[model samples]
Target: MRIKRLVQKHPEEKTFWKNDQWFNVYVQVNEEKRPDYKSRLYGEFDRFGFEAEDKYASLAEDDEHNGWRLFRRFKMVLHNNKRLTKDVTVKDFCGKQMTAFPLFVMSIKYLREHLLQAVTTQKIGIEETDILYVLTVPAIWDDNAKRFMRDAAVDADIDPARLKLALEPECASIWCETLGTDVKGAVAIAGSQYMVVDLGGGTADVSVHERKPDGSLKEIMKASGGPWGGIFVDENYMKLLDRLYGEEALTDLRKTEMSDYFDIIREFEHKKRTVDIKNTKHVIVRLSVSLRDLANKYSKQSLEERIAALDSHKNAITPKGKDKLKVDWTVIQSWFKIPIDLLIQHIKTLLAEPKMKRVQTVILVGGFGESQYVQDRIRKEIPDDLKYTYGTNVFQYFDENKYPDDKKVWENGKWQVPFCFKVYVRVNEQVKVDQQMTKRSTPNSKISLTAVYRTTQEHPKYITDPGCELLGTIELENSTDIPFEQQRLETTFMFGDTELFVKTKNKTTGKEAYMTFECFT
Candidate 1:
């Protein structure tokens, strides 16, 4: 209902996924009130978790506050894999069999409930029918993947007619259109070609577009991307830690201190965004007590001893405090290398293509696009002539053209004949001529007329209907004010279920003539 009220208040605004993260839902709001629609609700994808039947059953007995295990990163995996069909079941953390389709449906339902609750709390007035949903998918997703998403939405009660699919980069391009000249400046100029780099949490999508004179975009090349994203960076970091602490120790820490592990990753995300590989001397990451103890036990060395042994020309890692560790620039750079290298390679491949040769600017957007290291790597690796800009939000550029209403405008009316016609005449001192034409038709019959003109020379003047589908011409014997020999007029007519008439008048003599025609199907 809130979605409906929002639609009623601002019909142009539609609901959309903020990004591939799937952690938040962004609803477009009226631009007059808030230029940026930061309005978001929590996504329910991670809310449902698997637990032992006995534990879940006992928890269900309470009917509230039941513990649910959290499932994360599965959305990306499911979307990327072709073998994971709607009917295939996956094991959750608790080893419960859950179909991927229902998980998506549950997520959609959670989103809908949150939207409705927001509307109710805000006291907006409307109904379910007024809301339209737009889902954004990676441009690289094939038709089957897109269809699966649509089917999930439909199974969740989203109307098929009201649902729309959009490409992530194109959505970012639309948002770029809303940027002010003071911000985007000449890059927003019409006819400029831009490569939209959507570096989100799970993937880095790239697309090229040329801005049209009308402010719309023409896609110059197909979109391309890979699994290299912020998540991969996090995974690489985790792998590094696993190597240093031993896989068993890290696994134990994850099982025993899941919250602390999440916090550690979250801190890495912040550092990943702010870390300056060019100037920063060192980067510090917080470590939990359990993790530190486990690492020391598995490696048979004190945390400080390990740091001293691993120190090298590139950089060094040392214990910052009881709960933190300092990593030198070299170590941090190595962690960023995996994803950043992939990203740079992707951009190079795109730029090397003949179609992308003329593209001078690259517009970076999405979560990972906000990384300074990523941006710096691009600047260093890309051609000097190429330009790139970064922004956190660019969804406003996504436009959805919905289907038009099918209502008719005119009412049935009785058949009534209107008389109208056209005529042509020529006058000279020696001769005068006049022509008139008319058509007779029945209700069930069709009529067509054709006329030909013959002359010694071609006619310079001709007339045609508004659609230019029918024409008439007049010819004379010679190019003279007064015809010396013969004059002819030719006309052609084709009629269908409508009636038509033409009228012509002689301005000098104030004489008028008429012609009529009809058609039936």
Candidate 2:
């Protein structure tokens, strides 16, 4: 009936889909503690969510030597490397190797099993069949990446029929619109148009939605945004530390005193949230003695000495007492600048579009969206007017002037419209999963079918047109006993999938054959 928000301790680590509607996931890949911090598909590790993040960060040094790696952000697994197809095969901590697919399977299985157990225990009073599981994914993720998640979910034993995929920002818009009427800024009413910006740890996703008169929401703009999220701010913090302590010292800290290393970032994360335009006071962050001692050991200088020796940040950063650092509000705000600027730039671009002219409200959701600085920056830069597709299969935004009007069939009274098939479809623009059209043609005893062309091209409207290439063919056989006109060759064209299917049958003989052609994205 309604989405139930399951409160969790780690709000920052919670994935968008976990708002309890549908869920989406990303994984951290494990492997060599490479200096580059890029992820790799790993074996023998299944720690998930924020817990996975902490585990991966904690095991940074341990995994390099032992080969045991923990990972997160698995949802973007396909985005990082162009060559990786499905699950990648790599060695685990124990030196035993397997595909990353199993790790995802194991994680989803944990959730699926937990939910089923809850149902069995009466925690949830509903039939197993009544449950519809949704997996949320980024609008930027390619079809392969989305499919990779789908396959993982299917392998996890979540029934495919009950599973659906949602775009991160789109669903956030849905959640915002569905908020109770008593809530402030509640605009779920019909004709309300709003822009939803979902700023997660890895990326800032943007989308626009309008509530239709029928109580359903329609997207007015495609999803767009970039890697301007909380993690980048964290990276900026790390970079600052790298400058102060030197790379060697920070590496040593991560390897030797990992918890202290995590503590430093955690403290900064807290500071990042609290420091804003109104809070002009210097923020205090406690420094572990190990970090101070390590700084001395690695750089032959204490952190205090390093802070005093700084060039530009010299006055802004201060070594307070012995075990703490006092940072000027300006210095702290710089860490948020890059991400906020990037996010604002994107939001501005989306709002500037003519099609987005009617959108009046902007909804903010996601962990990074909690930042007062981020919120302020958006309001300051864009002033008013704020923004902002589907999970991939690379979609090209065709210019309105470039293509002919959408597919239409002249039928009874106004086009008996868009009752076609598809997971997502636009009004006046229908894409069927498998719409079959039957045409009857009289033929003799046999009909020769010569061609099956696999072309990515969508136009030309005929087989004789350019862009068609020969693939394979099949012939249909008929019974000679049937009347000439009655010996019908029934041809059916199915346009439900990425590939086009043609099914043929001989009316008199009951003989059948089919051919498939790949559709160009």
Candidate 3:
């Protein structure tokens, strides 16, 4: 049977999941006005126990009187397992004794960046109904972080109930649920566990589950995270480069002369996170010249010789335009090997416990997890009895074309490997119902056919005679082609019980505006 899925518009704002291969739709009310950015950050700060400087009468008075002054410089919220309660008497303008709650804000940049991502995602959708998911560390629990998430829901035009804020660990749990696997513990580890490790950036998070008689998995332990990740290693490498190049010389080079040159270096580092690199030589040379130029006052090394060395050292790293820049993993490994060895030791310690040993599988997750060097190292170091799993490695069940020779087998169109789950996504119907059913925004949607599919396992046995059918992935296109002053779209993919929604919105009036939908099954 031929089926077409029309996610009319604003797929960016919706969430998706795959079930008996049918689409379940949910709509979001995209807000018309931009929220007061400062207020939202204030809400987060307040939640984190960072009190306004207004707590001090003089500072409070100054801020109130000075309209243009941004009174708060930085704010942070930290979670503590301890409880402290204190009340202080302060005199108000009315000359009455008032009690004030003392508070402090945590200035952690990482936490601040996350709050910004959530806020930006809420405001900048190309479509009104775009869906976004933000990742967070599991154990770094803080009340203010939760408050920021709550504020995001309040600021959004869509039904606040539809927006979700998940601990990185919990998202992993949801992924496990999506995969339809109960193997949280032994013999097989699934996608969610791996996602947590990735979110953590470096730490290998392990979750154990019990396979029930009906074949569902239960939580063993959520997973642990550490500050050790590839980014941290990158910083270490930057420091090493500075030391090797001579620190003082590098700093002088960065400050005075060619500033844009250093920016390119950071760009290269950012590109490295996305793919593998086998070399970094020539790029380093260009950066070296830029740095030297920046130090216009001094010439430590003759420019010609330095440039020559840099060009000659083609062994530094290889750049692949955008996808990836290559760097010698061997050199990087040599510098970081001791720390990597130390990290492996810690992982081994956790895994060596009797309960951990019962873990059937170990999964590599995060950007670093994708590193060919790391993978090779882990495989070489691991005992023969242990094995690793990657999401990219498990594609055989879903797309045979991608893995034409995938050894994994499906019985009756069902994966024997277990953990196979469904995905579902939802977005709003084109029509809007305020107090009365009406068109709030111009109907901006398109309709098209894309080969879509869902596994038949989640289907009810009584409803249809079923084994497994390749329910083609429904590509959404609006048939009416209703034009909105602002065009937006949301697409959802439901995998098992959980839903992932992506949404994008664009101003139709903008000079450069065109709509296109790229759907993948």
Candidate 4:
């Protein structure tokens, strides 16, 4: 009943249909001495909640109770970069140990239930049967790794037929097709060849695609990527923190004061997006109060004293109060250089390949793609002819101009009117009439006619007089074959005819309308 009401409210719903919706599931091991495994669900869901909480919590937990014991990264690396062996064991947040394969299966099951609950609450009528579960893996993952992921999804209660393992870069490429020309820039148009650079927290995946005539895409190059991504940048930042305050102190802070550790990284992530390489100003890095106190207890001097010494050596460290350090722009740039340089080199290798020679655009997508520093570096270092664009820009462009008037038939009334038309009629017979009735007696009473005669003869007209008798009227019926849903009828005036004719055309059923009229005397 609700769906019926929705359809009535939005009569255009009949035009849109989709067989399935896909959700991307990413798995990782929590940060611990023996790390626990966790997973995050992406695509068409509350990504903000995932980012804030850092992990998928139970569906019943309130917002405040979530995100505790959340490990920010994963360490479940496959042996030989392939399948997971039977010996792989990981700890959960409960400190209980389980094999990596089972952990993945459990995480996926949680994600599945959460998504199903969401769909049920929304009353979208999307059952588990309608969903196609797609798990995205780094391009570096081999066939065995893909198989392991597929098996895990099946173990999570997803049908084997419904589960699919997708390469990250390829998935990003497919996503790019849904983006607009503005966000994607000029390169997103059909027939243009481009590469998708998916830079996420843990890995960077790259692949090339050529837009097809039908708006679909075809892969032109094999997927390629590495572990060089946002996580590496975070790692580099952590190394800097280790240098500022003793590494042991930082480690202690991570173990004993994880909330503060998460805060520090969260601040760094915010600054990383706004960091400008062209600006040579001092960038401030805030240290957690707990971290500063721990560093002071373990170091040779107070944290401030060490910062002063570093500043004297042009290391550009300035202690701001007891909890913040002012870092030189050059130092911050150095931290970005490691990951940016690696990403550039990887892109260079991709560009140099024979298959990639024709790539005209480079699309930067995913979490790390939001980094202004990363975007600036790639834009500058890459060849000038090859345009480098971000994923968000593409979506923005399309969102603004999603429905142009020319593409909408209903908006332009293309369906209601005939595309083009011709008129033809045969004269049935001529009858004798009274001479007085034939003559135009009164200017007001005479009907004016405009006619284009096919033969070199004058056209005749009917005269109305007091002596004229009324004849029976004939009405024409609309065609039954026309799809009433897609079209409507209109009355139009024509020249050279006194009779009214009806015509109907079915755009959906491809049925033509025949014009017929009856004459009465």
Candidate with maximal TM-score:
2
Error of 2 at 189 (Å): 0.9
Q: Given candidate 4, what's the lDDT at residue 306? A: 67
Q: Candidate 3, residues 1-521: lDDT per residue as tens digits?
A: 00112232465444343521223243323647533433222212221112222232233334331211112211111232223122322332223232212112222323444555776887765442454534343444455545544454443333455455555544554454454343344323332222223323444344444444555555556555444445555665666445334566565543333234334445645544433444432222224454544433354664333334553334555534322334454555564465457556655666566554444344555555666556555545543221211010011144555323344466545653322322231111111111111111222235322222233333221112244333333334443443543454333221211121222223243212122222221
Q: How many residue pairs collide in each prediction?
A: 8, 18, 104, 4
Model 1: per-residue Cα lDDT over 173-200, one tens digit each: 7787678663264346787787888988
> Which has the greatest lDDT?
2
lDDT (Cα atoms) of all candidates against the true structure: 0.56, 0.62, 0.37, 0.54
lDDT score at residue 101, model 2, on the 0-100 scale: 64
Please give, for residues 418-459, the per-residue lDDT of candidate 4 as tens digits. Answer: 111111222322211110111111111112121211211122
List of clashing residue pairs for candidate 4: 29-74, 183-393, 183-394, 184-394
Cα RMSD (angstroms) for every candidate in the order listed: 28.1, 26.5, 25.9, 26.4
Off by over 4 Å in 2: 1-47, 50-68, 72-76, 87-99, 118-125, 178-186, 385-521
Preferred candidate (lDDT higher): 1 or 3: 1
Candidate 2 displacement at residue 265 in angstroms: 2.1
Superposed Cα deviation of residue 17, candidate 3 (Å): 49
Evaluated against the true structure, the overall lDDT of model 4 is 0.54
Weakest 10 consecutive residues of candidate 4 by summed lDDT: 386-395
**TM-score computed on alpha carbons, candidate 1:** 0.58
lDDT, ranked from best to worst:
2, 1, 4, 3
